[model samples]
Target: MEMVVLENEPEVLMENISNKDNRDTSAAPGLKLYRCVAVSFGLLCILQIALNISLRPPLNHTNCISNSEDMTTNLTEERDELKRKLDDLKSHQNVLKSERDELKRTLNDFAHRSNNGWLYFSHSFYYISPIKKTWHDSRNDCLQREADLVIINSKEEQEFIQRWVKNLMWIGLSKRDGIWKWVDGTRLTQSLWCAGEPNNHKDSGEECGEIRGCGHDHGWNDEKCSNSNFWICEKKMAL
Candidate 1:
């Protein structure tokens, strides 16, 4: 019985050892599979990181594109503003040039008037004849010179003539049908008659107008058309 027990114990020990070896082999295969899986996971993580790094530049480029667009828009607006300013300056320069040309024309006209034996006053030219003659002869002389007898149209003109004339002078006024009228056929609108004058003092048929001087009233007086007196001639400025 002792021998049989010993043999059985030895067999049991050998069987246990074999079973442990089989378990160890199975565990080894499982560990190898786990290592392969871990390595694959690590490679996937590295790939994802590399992909993220490579894509970042595109996002930055998008921002740069937006910034470039903004700068281009600003430059376009500035260019438009400069163009407008240049147009305005050109307009102002044109106006100034026109004004200068007008002034030059005016100066030229004054010089021409001065050269033509005419004195400029109140936008008109005047000439004091050096000789005395009858009213009709004086009017004829003025016509030959392309002028006419002076016609006083304003108080200022009358006063100016009063100061300018050295003696009595014949004007372009005359009486027709007892009504005073200018040579141009306009009726008299103002009067510079002296007090108590125009009495037709002798019924001598006073028909011509004269600026009375010779140390007298220096006012308007009617006289016979045949009377002799110095005269003033007037002409309009050339356009």
Candidate 2:
């Protein structure tokens, strides 16, 4: 049917050819040639549109699958990275567990100690401001507790007693003639005095020694031994 129609349009085709011939050599094509070119482009457009309509479903599916694969690949890489970090953290946890176990074992090695008349850190001292019963009373009190007047020898020994013995106590660091001596035969290393310090009221009848430093009996000064004071004794036990 289409071929029969094309054959019947033979005069129209001859008219188109005649219009192309009338176009000048140096000028653009005539209207009839332009119309023919336009009709050919329209047919090409129609064919392309038909092909796209037929293939739309399958082509869309292919694109969707490609995009899904790319996303899955990215997620897989991220998951692998997370797994590696989890493994590293587990190893660190194991190390900490071992260290904690070792510390617990070490703590078990020591035993607890008990306190008795053996004289723990608890003790007190008394001092005589007036010429009370002579220096004799001070010496006797020190002996009764298995301790002597506080003698500050080394910093270590001084620190040990000073921690708790806050009250004024008779210290062995007394001036003999004019020289300071500790009952333990050790000399005082560091000495502290009060604001108007160590006036040595001994000449005013103050004898023996009294504690005059800032912290307490731990820091001592020369006073008359005739002054009475209580003494401290220190003894330790092993665990």
Candidate 2 residue-wise lDDT, 176-224, digit = tens: 5655666666655666544555676646644455554464344655556
Q: Name the best candidate (by TM-score).
A: 1
lDDT of 1 by residue, 1-239 (tens): 35434658878999999999999997998999999999999999999999999877555778899999999999999999999999999999999999899889877866875897777778778888888899989998988877898889988887777767856789998899989998889999888876766767799988898888534558888888898899998876643
Per-candidate TM vs. native? 0.52, 0.36
Query: Over 4 Å off in model 2, which ranges?
Result: 1-135, 144-146, 186-189, 212-218, 234-239
Please report how far candidate 1 places residue 236 from its true position, in Å: 2.1
In candidate 1, the residue pairs with backbone N, CA or C atoms under 3 Å apart (3 or more residues apart, or in different chains) clash, namely none
C-alpha lDDT score of every prediction, in listed order: 0.84, 0.58
Error in Å for residue 40 of model 2: 99
Return the lDDT, model 1, position 143: 87
